[model samples]
Target: MFLKPLLHDFRLALIQLHVSAVKSENLQRACGLVREASAKGAEVVALPECFNSPYGTQYFKEYAEKIPGESTQKLSEVAKECGIYLVGGSIPEEDGGKLYNTCAVFGPDGAMLAKHRKVHLFDINVPGKIQFRESETLSPGNSFSMFDTPYCKVGLGICYDIRFAEMAQVYGQKGCQLLIYPGAFNLTTGPAHWELLQRGRAVDNQVYIAAVSPARDEKASYVAWGHSTVVNP
Candidate 1:
């Protein structure tokens, strides 16, 4: 009798999410996608930043949920049902009444694996285009977070945090084989900076980098530049 080979491999799914003001609708869409990815044999699925809410400082307070709040609960249930690892993406989390842009990860068993609040806020001014002041509504995260999975050691980073090479280096130093960034890069920077930044991070760290961005929203207060991508080491 021939024995089947034991495989210790992993596959990733990047969700180029399209967010909206309706949190319930977005959650339903994300859950559906996650299920589809799992059915397609993805062991891990990642969603874009602010998947549970709208991006922009103005909507932070209104959309903010607690860490283990509704958004996380929904993601946890999905992760458990699909038997896959899930990066729940960044959501506006209300911590002690202050808002923080946060990302949560769940294991195959739906256990909370790790959480990372966006350390670098998107605060920039581009002439004749968009202006973002994340600090005005959201507080910056002070601690760095990483976790282990069945596939490999993984690093976590939210949208603007990807722009910092130092952070990526830190993850590389921590023995991370793959880094996940959930973000919403805008039209102003998305076209010029998004892919370049992902490639740069992968080249610099010599590791796989996956970035998930919310699909473009032209009618919303802030338009998202969406081109969800994955790059290998």
Candidate 2:
């Protein structure tokens, strides 16, 4: 069932999510956006990274939830309601004693299709410039994720994964035509290479790349770069 070829046009909805400290509020906002996009004729709807929680390592453990938890459950139900494939942005997932940055994918039937844990952890520090460390609290995923859709094979990658060309090549070589990345690049790095990275990946792999990011909130302590856009194959 997963190996079949899909060759057709697909309308993708990139949910420019607005994240907050309030988990419930973020979920509600995302749901509304998903419904709105589905009504507009999108076959697939996606949310940004950390859509249900604030984008900070200090807050990850506090906001972490197990799979089938509140956020995933609501996203699944919404996907079923709208009858569209849903890429449930990245969420902080708690499994046993470890926590991971995970992205959940749901089919139109509302069943979970894939849970791609972010393989690359963002850990960069430039002293006075900017410093963020995900590896300090989050565990990295061990495998790549790809799934079939009505249009083609869709690949999954979280924020930092976009910087890796080999990762994109692996997916492209495996016959994926679209790469869906739920990312939240900070203002520092976003302005420098966000669009450049997306376009570069598409041109290199000859695949469509859509990057979904949370809307920038000035009041929030951690501001996300909210430039959610897609590039052609």
Candidate 3:
């Protein structure tokens, strides 16, 4: 069980940008936020889930970008320019006719550090309240991802992955002090279980947890609850 102490100088920033149907604009908006975070003394800047496209699975197909592709290329440059570790939130990934919700982590030199394909897909139906099934379009990732940093090893997961404690525990057991999950929790469940689960994992594992969610946009097809949160244990 590796729960190392965090670096004293570590300052992480969570970017909460409103995503839209426009991909180019969305990327640019994220870039601007990255600069803002860097200027504010954030050594590691993280974005919210589905930062480049709409939160719905229907939009995933249209907006899905290939890994090591355009979205990544730009993110690499941004990380290099800012000289900071960058957590790319989650992007719809298109690989071999299969789509996955994936998040990419970039090193300070702009090199790809690690990529985590969401192992758990968000599939929930609240009857007339809310119904979303990511499994309809996204294939669950089979592996766990953890990357080393000057501060500590960071475990990566996407939205629904938060519901699972085993995954986070494995990361901590293997020597991870920080866990980050880029997510989009809806209005229905976000209010109820979002923070509860975050705090639960942190308290149980004695690790720092950060979960970033897209900014609330009621105008969009799927409205996100819009509370990007953090818990320290």
Off by over 4 Å in 3: 1-3
| Regions of candidate 1 where Cα sits further than 4 Å from its true position | 1-7
Model 3, span 1-233: residue lDDT tens: 34466766589999989998889999999999998899999998999999988988789999998999888888999999999999999899999999999999999899999999999889999989998899999998999998888888899989899999999889888888899999988899999999999998998898999999899998999998878888998
What is the descending lDDT order?
2, 3, 1
- Which candidate achieves the best lDDT against the true structure? 2
Score candidate 1 by lDDT: 0.89
RMSD of each: 4.5, 2.9, 1.2
Q: In candidate 1, list every pair of residues with a backbone clash.
A: none
Predictions in order: lDDT? 0.89, 0.92, 0.91
lDDT of 2 by residue, 53-128 (tens): 9998999999999998999999999999999999999899999989999999999999999999999999998777
Deviation from native of the Cα of residue 143 in model 3, angstroms: 0.8
Candidate 2 residue 34 C-alpha distance from true site, Å = 0.3
Candidate 3 has an lDDT of 0.91
In model 2, the Cα lDDT at residue 8 comes to 74
Q: How many Å off is the CA of 175 in candidate 1?
A: 0.3
Superposed Cα deviation of residue 59, candidate 1 (Å): 0.8
